[model samples]
Target: RWSEIDIDNAMWTIPAEREPLPGVKFSHRGSKMRTPHLVPLSKQAVAILTELQTWAGENGLIFTGAHDPRRPISENTVNKALRVMGYDTTQEVCGHGFRAMACSALIESGLWSRDAVERQMSHQERNGVRAAYIHKAEHLEERRLMLQWWADFLDANREKFISPFEYAKINNPLK
Candidate 1:
């Protein structure tokens, strides 16, 4: 289950994925969604979510488990989808790796501080507050942007043959 939740303007109805967190809802995948999961969405993430909206087909849950329907997707299923999508899941490219992927994106973007980055990753907030006591899902915009960027990067690089390190120069310069 997600560690926190926040309701903004009361417009975004983050469901009660877990109890006591009204605005923050856990992904349909539940506990498997990863902790400190405030990873910002790159452009690629936006596109994927937008694309995924269609697959949702008016369903409430975005990522539902197969054969269960009631529970959220598992990390295994997510990685399996990646494997089918051509990623080498066996090479440490599992679903949990998305945190690193997204964090790398944020650092490359130069739009996030370490604290913000950690908060976004849901690793732990940049602030001194413990993740358990912290209830605010900050950096929604940054996460959105981060995911979008990641999505865009993926889309752009899907056809390439270079390693991510090779692509990093094109996407972001090293200091």
Candidate 2:
């Protein structure tokens, strides 16, 4: 929803519960952890969202269903789209696979801390004691930088593909 996005600040806050809007039928029970997740948007993300705002309806949904303007897209929508694009969703890649692919790439890059990347992925520590100790560490600044780098890396390799390790060797931002 538009209410969750702060375009000016380059931030997207995924609330724990959906903020009810008049006339909207669906209520999204936010993240899996039942906690608000702050995602730092990259420049590319902000640009894409700015363009999407032009198509946003009165209900403030960024991506609504084709059949019903008031409702968000169904869970299978993305997978269907991917299948149409010639990908075998079952064998090749599904919607959720993108998350795993990105997480793997981010870890392979070796530029970001594990904590920052996991937090960015909205993953909570499974260990109760560890979760308690590190609960306050948002790592927002590091995540912001990491996300921007990830965007840049993707943009740079969009036309000519290279492995993350090879790309890091050539264009290590820290170096």
Per-prediction backbone clash count: 27, 0
lDDT of candidate 1 over 3-90, digit per residue (tens)? 2222221112233243432333444322323433433334434455667666763334566667654455665888788888999987
Q: Which candidate should be chosen as best, given TM-score against the real structure?
A: 2
| Model 2 Cα lDDT, one tens digit per residue, 73-171 | 777899999999999999999999988987888889888889999999999999999999998899999899888888888997888988777777776
Model 1: how far residue 15 lies from native, Å: 6.4
The regions of model 2 sitting more than 4 angstroms off are: 20-26
Residue 29 of model 2 has an lDDT of 78
Could you report the Cα RMSD, in angstroms, for every candidate shown? 7.2, 2.0
TM-scores of the candidates in the order shown: 0.52, 0.92
- What's the CA RMSD of model 1 in angstroms? 7.2
Note the Cα lDDT for every prediction shown.
Answer: 0.53, 0.87
